[model samples]
Target: MAKTQYYTATSIDGYIADANNSLDWLFEVDEGTANPFGEFFAGVGAFAMGATTYEWVLENDNLLEEPQNWHDMYGEVPCWVFTHRDLPPVPDANVFMISGDVRRVHEAMLVAAQGKNVWLAGGGDLVAQFAQQGLLDEIILGIAPAVLGEGTPLLRHKLHVDELILTGVREVGQFAYLTYAVGDVARMGRHLAAETATLLPVNF
Candidate 1:
């Protein structure tokens, strides 16, 4: 079955980007020869990203000038970018710019993905939006051996311990990779309600 997954790298302190919204620190990490992103991307037939992430890629990779780079990386796979402002698209790349209602966009992504998984390439806020709607299925985090005092978090929303099951763990060079299976939101809500009831005062 195709699942919605968030795969991204973060600092040791759980920051995806620095206070300046820069990922230069991540690029400095030595991935060695065990990087798993290739394998992960192969299973992703379609992907989505926030405006910030898309802009970063555009700037760093020079997608506007050298559009072939985008093609070389993703081939014909479709990509949906969530943005409120007008942003230039990469020539010849399968990119869709849209905004509002992640649920609706998620449905489109599922269809575009065919039988493969959908990747949520994101800024923390964007991923949180999907999580809040119970649209996220899994989280794969690559923790780099660095820390940023303040910056963009891995996820802006709260994920209770009971809502995540650790499925895998591995070390790749200076990075620690962790995979988690997201639990059903309805079950988690019920658990929270029960816990809250128990904590309430019982007055005669």
Candidate 2:
């Protein structure tokens, strides 16, 4: 089975990008620490992102024209971009454009994933949508030291997360990378119920 994961940085206030949909605040960190993120990306089999994130990369020409060292690390993994409007394809065949209902896009992603990890390269709203639908398996957050007064939050609206176990924490200079394994709600509920039963007072 393929695992769906969300990997993003957030402000101390839990915002992913600024009000203008800019991630300038996150860039303030010393770029040296970004190697770990590249390593994390290398482990993934494929990539998936919302239309806005795809456009942002294209407009700015941020993504490298050719596969970088990180891309080599991951081999020729596929990347699917979910968009509402039509857009030209990337130079590399590895990158594909997808437009349709989000669920259908997800199904296509899973097929493209093919037992490998699927990265949900988010721009906030899209991530929130998948998170709300309970499609997310893990959330890998690179918590920056800086704070943003206002921006797009990583999570919006109410979500019932049964539990999030901290798998690992790494301190990269001033920033910290946190890995969390978000468990299934039903399994967590059962464990919580058992614990509650043990803690409750027994009247015989």
For candidate 2, the per-residue lDDT at 172 reads 76
| lDDT per residue as tens, model 2, 64-127 | 5543532454457787777778876655557777765667777777877777777888877777
C-alpha TM-scores of all predictions = 0.90, 0.77
Model 1 residue pairs with clashes: none
Tell me how far candidate 2 lies from the true structure as C-alpha RMSD in angstroms: 4.2
Candidate 1 wrongly placed segments (more than 4 Å): 185-204
Angstrom error at residue 113, model 1: 0.3
